[model samples]
Target: MNGLSPSRRRARELVEPQHWVSGATESVAGLCQFVLLLRLGATLMLVVAAVLIEPDPRTLLLGTLVAGTVTAAELAVLVRHPVAVVRWPVFVLVELVAGAAIAGLMEGGPVFFSFSCGSAAVFGVAAGLRAWPVWVVQTVAAYAVVAWIIRADDVPATLAVYLTGVPTLYVLVGLASATARAAVIRHVNLARSALEAIERSAVAAERTRVARELHDSVEKTLRGLSFAATSLPQAVQQRPQLAAELARTVAEGARTAADEARELLGMLRADDLDASLAQAIERACQEWAVRTGLRADTDLADVEAALPVRHEVLRIVREALGNVARHSGAAHAWIDLVREGSTLRLTIRDDGHGFTVPGDLNHLSAAGHYGVVGMAERARQIGGRLRVFSGDDLGAVGGTQVVLWAPAGAMAPMSDRVRT
Candidate 1:
C-alpha cells in the first residue's frame, strides 16, 4: 500500500524473488516446457489449417508469414528472458495487435479465426496468475477489432465462444497450478530448515556428553598414571618396595584407562547416571593416594541430589583430585561434602603450591589447562556455581580450594538461581 501496488510487487517477486525464484524456476521447469511445446504444436496446426483453406491465397499467404514471424519473435523473447516471462503482457499485447491486423487482412475466414483461437490459448497460459487480465483484454480487443472489420453477423457464434471460453479456463488453471506449486515449495523449505536445526542440536548434545564422559573416566586414570610415572624413579633409589608399588599402580591405571575408553565408546547411546557422588569421590581419592603417596582426608555428610547433579558432582570431584595428583603436587588433599538447609556444598582443598587465581576463568583454556574450565561447565550444567581460590587467598601457606554450591533440588531452573 505504501509503495508499488500489490499486483506489481507480486509480478516482480515472481520474476526474481530471493531464493524463491530460483527454486520456483526449477519446480515449474517441466510444466513450462510442456506448455511451450503445446503452444508451438498449436501454432503448427493453425499454419496447416491456413494453407489448407483457399479463399484469397495472397492475403492468406501474407497472414501466414506474419503469424509465423510473430510466433518466432515471442518464442525468442521467452527463451532469452525466462525471468521476464511474468511480464508477458507487454510482448503479448504486441503479438495480439499484429495477430488482429493479420486477421483483418484475411477477411472473416476460417484460417484467421483458427489462428487467433490457438494464439489466445498460448497467451492465456503464459500470462499465468499475475497478468491474466492483460491476456483477457488483449484477446477481447483483438476479437472486437476483427469482428468490427468483418462485421459481427458474418463471424460465426462458435468462433466467439471458442475465443473466450478456452483462454479463460486455461488462464484460471495456470493461476491455480502456479499458486499450489509455490505453497508446496515453501512447505519443503520449512521442513528442511527444521531437520537441519534438529541435526545440529543432536550433534551439540553428543559433544557435551562425550566431554563429560572423558572427564569422569579416562582423564582420572591418566592423571593417576602420570603421578605414578613421575614418582617411580625417586622411590626406586630410596625405597625399592615403594618403586615396585608405583610400577604396579601405573600398569593398573593404564588398564583402567583402556577399559574406561571402551566403555565410553558404547556410552554414546546411554544417559544413565548411576554413580554415587560420595563413594565415587572416596574411590578417586584412594586411587590418587596410591599413585602419588599422598594423604586424602574425606569428610562426607549425607546429601540428596538428582541423578544428573550427582553424576556431575562425582565428575567434578574426580577432576579436582586428578588436578591435585598432576598439577598441584599437593602432599595432602581434603574433600568435604556437606548439606546446609536447602543447599549442598562440596569443597576440595589441596595443601600444595598454588598458582595465582585468574579473574577470567576462560584464560584456563587459553593456557592449555581445561580441568578447571571443564569443572565449571559441569557445575553450570547442574545449575550450580564453582569457585576456585588459590595463592594469597589461602593465607601465608598457599594452597588451592575449589568449592561447588548447588541447590538440593538439582532440577530447579538455572534462571531461578542468583548469578554472581
Candidate 2:
C-alpha cells in the first residue's frame, strides 16, 4: 500500500472494507440491519429445531447454549449498534468461534448446517468485501469443523459433499453483498454531485441577471439624473427659466431612478417568470404605451421559452421600450413577436428620429448607451443575436429597429406554454 502511487493509494483508501460501514449511506445501513434480522430469526428457529430433534440430551443442551449465547450477543451488540460488530476485531472472532462450535456440537445436522451458512452470510455482509481475509478465516474454520464431524460421526457420502460445498457460499454471498454496497454508494455520490452543480449554475445565472437588471434600469436612470443635476448650476445664474426646467428634470429623474430600483427589487422577490412569454410581452407593451402616451401596436405569435430565456427577453423588450420613451421623439411604436422556423424573432420599431447604428453594439456602454449594450448582452446570453437598424444605413425611413433572433434550443416546447 505504501509503495503505490498517490492516485492508486487514494483509490485503495476509498474501497477499504471498514469504510463500507463507517461511511454507510442510509440505504446501506438499512441493508445491514435487515440482514442481521434475518440471521437472528434463522438462528432462533434452527436452535429450537436442534433441541427437539437431538436424541442425546447433553449434546442438545450444549448446542442450544452456544446458539443462544451468540444470538444474545448479536442482539445486544450487532442489533443496537451494527457498526460495532464490524469495527471491533473481538466481535469478528466471536462470530467465527460461534459458527465452529455450532457446527461441531450439532454434528453437521441439516438444520444446524443451514444455520452455520446463514452465519457466514451475515458476517460477510457486515464485514464488507475489503475484509476478505476475515471471510477466508471463517470459511476455513467451517470446513475444518465439518471435516471433524464427518470423520467422528459416520456421516453419509452425500451429506459429506453437501457439508464441504456449503462453506463456499460464505465467499459468494460476501462478494455479492460487498459489490452491491459499492455500486449503491457510487450512484448516490454521483446524484449528490449533479444536484450541487445545478445549484451552482442557478446561483451564477441569478448573479448575472441582477447585474443586467442594474445596468438596464436603475443605472440608466441615475445617469440621466446625474446629467440633469450637473447642468442645473450653470442655468441658475444665466437663465432662471432654463434653471427651473433643469431642476424639475433632476427631481423627476431622482424619483424615476428610485422607482426603477424598487421595481427591480420587487421583481427579484416575485416568481413572475412562470407567465406566458407572448402574453407578458404584449402586456408590457400596453403598459408602456399608457405610461408614455405613445401609440404602441403589438403583433405577437404564440410562443414559449425556458424561464431564463423568457427573463432575458422581457428585460430586452423593456429596455428597448424605455429607449423609445426617452430618446425616440416618436409618436408611435410597433412591436412584433413571431417564430421563423427554428428561431424566435422579436422586433421593436419606433417612428422617432433615428441615431446611427454603431459598428460594434458592445461599445454602446462606453458611449453611455447602457440600455442598448444590455439588450445586446441579453440576446447573446439566450443563444441569440441582436441587430440594430437605424437611419438610411439599413433602409429605415426615420426610426430605430431593434431585432433579436433566438435559436430554438433556448426555447421550450409549444406544449409547455403557460397561460397568464
Candidate 3:
C-alpha cells in the first residue's frame, strides 16, 4: 500500500502541465490529444457507415479513399504541431476546409449528413475550449454549410437536424470544454499567487534577520567605541592609571566587535540552506546542549518545506533555545517538529524559571529582547504564528513553551497575527 501510494502520485504528476508541457508551444497538448482521439473515432465511424450504405460502392470507395488520405495527412500534422491549430483564424479555416471536403464527397446520404454534424460538433467544442471567439466563428460557418447541404435533399428533415442535433451537441460539448479549461486556468493562477506570496514572506524574514544580526554585533560594538573615545580625554587629565585602563578597554572592545562582525558575516554565508529542516534543528539542538550543559530531547518528524521557510523555522528554534540557555536556567529542554495535515507545528519547551510574556510582541523590542521579537518576525515571514506560553500563571512547574505553526507548503501569505 505504501509503495503503491508513491507510484500513484508519480502517475498523477506525469499529466500536470508543469511536468508534461513546460513550454507555451505545448501548452494545449493534453487538450489536443483528447480532441484528436475524438475526431479520429468520429471520422472512422462516418467513413465506415458511408461505405456500407452507398448504392455505387466502387465510386463511393474511391471518393472515401481520397478523403481518408487527406484527413490522415491533416490529422498527422494536427497531432505533431497542435499549437498551430489553436490559433483562432487557423483553427476555423482548417476545420471548415476539411469538413467541406468530407461533406462534399458524399453529398446527399444520411451518413454524410450525420458526419457533417459530428465534424461541426467536434470543431466547435475544441474551439470553445481553446478560445470562445473561435467557437462563435466556427458555429456561424458550420450553420451556413448545413443550410446549403439540406436545401438539395429533404428540406424539413435537414432543417430539423440543423435546428435540433447540431446546435444541441455543439453547445453541450462546448460548455463542458470551456468549464474544464477555466478550472485548469484558475488552479494554475492560484498556484502562481501562492508561490509569489511565499517569496515575499521569505524576503521580509531575511531582512529582519540581517537587521537583527547587525544591531547585535556591529551596532553594539560601535556604540561602545563612541562612548570610550568620548571619555578618553577626561580619563587622561584626571588620572594616568584610569587613562591606561580606559585605553586597554577601548582596544579590547574594538577587537571584540570586529571579531563579532566577522562571525556574523560567516554565519550569513553558511551553506545550511541545502540541509533538511529536521537535520538542521537536530544539529542546532546538539550544539545548544553541548554549550549550555542542558539536555535536549528532540522529536523531529520528516516534513517537506521550502528553503526560506526552513531557514526561518531553524532560526526560531535557535532563538527559543538561546532564551532557554541565557534566561530560563533550565536543566532540560524539549523540541518537537511534526507535520499536522496542512500545517507544520514546532514546539520547544524548557523546565526553567519562566518569565511573563507580554500581550504585545512589540513590547519585547522596546525591552531590548530582540531574540523574542526576531522569532516572531521569522514566524510572520513564513505565514506562520508564534505563541509564547509561560510564567507563574501556568499550571505546570516553572517552564516556558514556544510554539510556531506554519503552512505545510510554506506558500501562504504573511500572517496578520504576527506583530511587526
Instruction: For residues 30-122, write the lDDT of model 2, one tens digit per residue.
Output: 565566567667766765776677666576566656766676666566556544533434546676677667666666564455555555555
Off by over 4 Å in 1: 1-12, 15-22, 55-128, 149-420
Measured by TM-score, the strongest candidate is 2
Candidate 1 local lDDT, 1-420, one digit each (tens): 249887657665654355543344433433444554555566567666766775656776677667667666666665665545565567567756776777677654544554555454454444445556654665565556545644655547776665445434434554555565556457656766788798998678667767868876689779979989999999999999999999998998798789668645633323333544555566666766887788889876656587567767876876788788779878889888777767789999988999887997879977757779878988998899999999987888678999999877532333332111
Better of 2 and 3 by TM-score: 2
Q: Per lDDT, what order, best first?
A: 2, 1, 3
For model 2, the local distance difference test gives 0.72
RMSD of 2: 9.8
Model 3, residue 240: displacement in angstroms? 5.0
Residue pairs with clashing backbones, model 2: none
TM-score, prediction 3: 0.50
Ranked candidates (TM-score, high to low): 2, 3, 1
lDDT of 3 by residue, 1-420 (tens): 255666444433433424432232243445544554665566567667866776676655554555455446656775776544344345456555655665576553443434444444444434444445544654665566566666665678656565545634554556666565445545656766788798999789778878976885579768878888888999899988988988987898798678667656655665276666677788778877988788999877766697667767876887788789878989999998877778999999989989888998779877657678778877887799998988965666669999999977632332311110
Model 2 earns a TM-score of 0.54
lDDT of each: 0.67, 0.72, 0.66
